[model samples]
Target chain A: MARSSNGESVFSRVVRILEAFGPERPVLGVAELSRRTGLSLATTSRLVSELVEHGWLERGPDRRLTVGMRLWEVASRASPALGLREAAMPVLEDVHAVVGHHTQLSVLEGREVLFVERLSAPGAVINVTRVAGRLPVNASSSGLVLLAHAPAAVQEEVLAGPLESYTPHTPTGPGKLRALLAEVRRTGVAVCPGFIDERATGVAVPIRLDGRVVAAVSVIVPNDGGAHAQIPLLQAAARGIARAMRPGQE
Target chain B: MARSSNGESVFSRVVRILEAFGPERPVLGVAELSRRTGLSLATTSRLVSELVEHGWLERGPDRRLTVGMRLWEVASRASPALGLREAAMPVLEDVHAVVGHHTQLSVLEGREVLFVERLSAPGAVINVTRVAGRLPVNASSSGLVLLAHAPAAVQEEVLAGPLESYTPHTPTGPGKLRALLAEVRRTGVAVCPGFIDERATGVAVPIRLDGRVVAAVSVIVPNDGGAHAQIPLLQAAARGIARAMRPGQE
Candidate 1:
């Protein structure tokens, strides 16, 4: 099913080459790419040059290569992620203004939750999620909302094993997580306190389209006593986003 | 200077193949790609297979191909665009909340304005800019700010001629555009009405970093009247975004 039995096709090797980059390490030399991808120097060089020629990778003044602007432009245009983000932006802005906290939009991708968009206040509570970044489906409030509506297989597989907890409050066992997920489904909202960090409590609500939950909108509030007002605001924002995403409207 | 005389490098070809996927047409057949890229069918087939193997492209149920989630993940992770967008998001969110219009961040990419982000209210004013899309330098407020701050040679090249006009309000003539650019530099903002469309007004302010303009923040207000209130909010947000992008901050 593949080539290079380095067990990767030229493409998979290329993808492996790209997967090495992150927020921390954006630029890399060919050697670094080869080391990271565990590909040979020759193969890495050839592929790197090819990518550079195509504008998928750009060579900077220091001769380090990074994912090119062209690649970003190409990948971004008309993506499902882009559509959801656009549709949710206005409502998210309203929520952010009223809440004055971290407003985020996430969708289920694979067994994890991928953050599609997020807006933070200058002095808002610290958040671990980033746009295009992923969090475990069992961790963030956005993740729980996404996971609750996720396919049954995904839920079963996630609940089957090793649920990593970021804080003592994060549900580590299957039974508790299942219950929490059930609550999320029933209430159409999830509040995760000290789940990712002790200082923050995340409140999220699901955004649905075509009769299924397609996205989740969340706000990370500083952990405090009773911010009961957040749930309704988030739910209203989610509904606004859902309405916005519908065709022939807005 | 380029190895792509036939205008094909495995990388560039890969980019072309990827670029063919857009918001309106996210999936296409190999033959469609071949025609779209002007690459031979054989070449297109080989490259598409390679791209799919690499996770840069995915095969649909109908045998069409699309830009893959993996590619978007990797590209978005490493892009400089993300850094700019992140720094701008909090402030942009504020502007979106305050003005309740189209809030955008853009940078100069050659002679065009490359929009990195856009946030709009559900019923916000209509705007032509799209995230990851480009607009001509003389036709967008963001473009005007970048043009005003651009190096002399680049500025000259852009102002010389062949400026495409989107509407009568577009500053296409060299003399008038030069004056407009100077005005933008003087006030640190550009107010463009009907430059791209008759019903919209784009007001942009430079986002300065290290005493230089690195990006522009703008809001598209309806031509009807609310333009005045939007400018101050947009300018303040632009300043905030600039401050956030400063070294060792946020």
Candidate 2:
């Protein structure tokens, strides 16, 4: 890759510019983008124009830049998770219908739990997880299940302390979390009350493919002693998803 | 925008490389990518390596390339359609439950109908539409509805001919399509039985925001004498989604 005089590759600069947009700020002007990306205004303007012309970015009526539908189309159609999400959708819908709250599918990515798909009712329990959103691998039930199956290096890195708590019930200490992980690995499920929010409980089960855990199926419901009852349903859904995602099944 | 010795911008080259991966071929090796993108093997290798480092592409165990989850994450999170899709989910779910087949949400993009989201049951009906897939504007019910509300230039362009036919029931002539577009605009719905497949019927209605058509919500069901009955339910769902997508509701 060719680099500029400042030793930055065009690819890296472009990534920085794209990263400036998020769910909170979906549209921005070139000036705002330059400020956010720490790039000079001239470079930002030229790069934005090129991106717009290529359909990876769009210029709105007000001239603000937004991520384009074309980019979304390409990313979504070629996504590695598309097959997994497609296979999991029906099962997740069934789980959501039965559990009557937030049902989610997530995978461990870069020491965090990235939600690939989520189904929620209008008045379901409070859930901070969104599709394509990330939660720390040590704070949520899905994260706990994934952490339980992660490599020893990742486990030790997360267990080396400094795990932030979302609520009083969230496990922040290394010793308690180690015990919880052992229980999850043994029981094939992780249940935590008010781990993410004080008003909700999260239950998750590992989804295995070819005898290896690839994802987690989870549901969030009211923290009212109902966590254990939802486990069987989640486990069943996880099993169904695993079958659907098996090699040659997709 | 510095260009290579051949005068092609790096951004355009990158776009071509990304576009080489699609639904039919989601993974490719460097040699195959070089052939597909018309870029030299060395250039393709350098670009692929840069993209892999940025998490825009991934190398499989067998050394084939695939779209990365991080790219999907960024595009899905920052997508302009996210707000509309989020607001339309519940309505789509309700329609899916009632319709028990394929419920799709589509938008017009560059003379093609792009399906943004789709919901399907396990054994509902034989449908060809997939999420993030595209269909010509003259071949699908959703396409007709969108084309009816599209600009006059786009209408003329489609009407100029070369309308591909998927089934005998599809309108191939300019005269019949003009009539169909008028009927769609007048009735606020497009019903085409056996348009795409002999076994399925397509029923669609336009979803409007600020008095302008923004998308089409449609359902595909078994091609029987029951398409008209679904129009009312589909129209109601479209109205609900329109209401939900209005400013401040999302």
Candidate 3:
């Protein structure tokens, strides 16, 4: 492993450089990347050039850098999330057709819910979650179901405190969140009305694989008191996804 | 920018290690990685440990290494492919629903067609393309559509090459490929029957953004006479995807 003058490994610096990019700012100039990563301009330039050479970063016509298709290909082709998304996609489409809103698949990553896939109609309700985006564990129905089935340590960690509130309906107190988790576990579903946004209701159910909850399937629909009607649809879709994900199937 | 005694940079070694993992073999032991990457065991071990610490690589309970979710998240969240896939997904779903087979979105990556998104229903046609997988520029309908609209240099490079034939129907000769490209440009579609598989037919259309062909939308259905009937559906879906991708639309 090569080390910089400051004793940071080259890999660490590379990670910092890659982390500087996000959905909101997919492209950046060398100076902007250096400023964002806090690396020296010379070091950033050297690293970016090396990355571009390897096809991990690409320069557009204007010479701004974006994460290369090669990088996405290498990372995505074998990703665990890809496997789950592939298994869930058919059912997700079915749910999207029936729900006519934002239907998504999410998994617990560390302490947050990372949306792996989402299907939405053109004029559906507004959804803050995008593919590969994360939301706090207490602010979305998918997060609630995942949190309910999460291990005790993870549950305790999220329950420790400081839950970020997205809307007035979002559970902020630990006790309220604990009760919500218990309700989700008991009901095998999570329904949060106006949790993330006042205009949408999120309904989610656990997707099990070999009897363990591995992911959540959710629908975000208009919060017009009809969110619960889609609970059975989501649950059935979740089961179909789990069945499709089983080994020896397609 | 740290270089080894052999003058290979750390970034180069990392790329080699990552490239060793693919859709077929997503997990490997340290020894297997070292063997595949041709790196010293000590160097591979040290670098793997560093990568694991940074969440670029993960060790499963069985002590095998897989690309980490953090790495996938970073690569995917800001990927240009993700933007295109998001734009095409709804139309892809509609196509899948109507075709009852594989509907895919692909882009020209280097000299190959790289599938960015695919929607398939259960028991659909036997299609080999997976999301993030690549096919030769002359072996599939999506590839042909993209290659037909690619820059002259790219077209010439592919034209000058030894095109790999998957089936007898595949166009392996430059003259035939040239005719195919001309036909795709003239008719705005590519319909390759049994090019990759004897049981499937691929139909594709170009997707334009700002009057420049940006991607290809394709469907793989059973090799029946009905393949031509799908051309209009595919063209409309392509137009919808292009309109959806327009700036400030969503």
Candidate with top TM-score is: 3
Q: Between prediction 1 and prediction 2, which has the larger lDDT?
A: 2
True contacts kept of each: 0.61, 0.69, 0.83
CAPRI grade, predicted model 2: medium
Error of 3 at B141 (Å): 0.8
Q: Model 2: per-residue lDDT, tens digit, B142-246?
A: 999999999999999989958889999999899999999999999999998999999989999999988899999999999997999999999999999999988
lDDT of 1 at A20: 86
Ranking of all predicted structures according to DockQ, beginning with the best and ending with the worst: 3, 2, 1
Question: Number of backbone collisions per candidate, in order?
Answer: 4, 0, 0
- Positional deviation of A195 in candidate 3, in angstroms? 1.0
lDDT of 3 by residue, A1-250 (tens): 7788889999999999999999999999999999999999999999999999988899999999999999999898888889999988888988889889999999999999999999888789989999999999999999999999999999999999689998889998999999999999999999999998999999999999988999999999999999999988988898899998987974
How far residue B130's Cα lies from its native spot in candidate 2, in Å, is 0.7
* lDDT of candidate 1 over B82-201, digit per residue (tens): 988988887776677667678889988768998999876656767877898899999999999999999999999997869998888888999999999989988878888888889999
- Candidate 2: where is the Cα deviation over 4 Å? A247-250
Off by over 4 Å in 1: A1-7, A225-228, B1-7, B29-31, B39-66, B122-124, B223-235
Best by DockQ: 3
lDDT: worst 10-residue window of model 1 chain B: B1-10
Q: For residue A7, what is the lDDT in candidate 2?
A: 91
TM-score of every prediction relative to native: 0.88, 0.97, 0.98
TM-score of model number 2 = 0.97
lDDT (10s digit) by residue, model 2, range A201-229: 99999999888889999999999997899
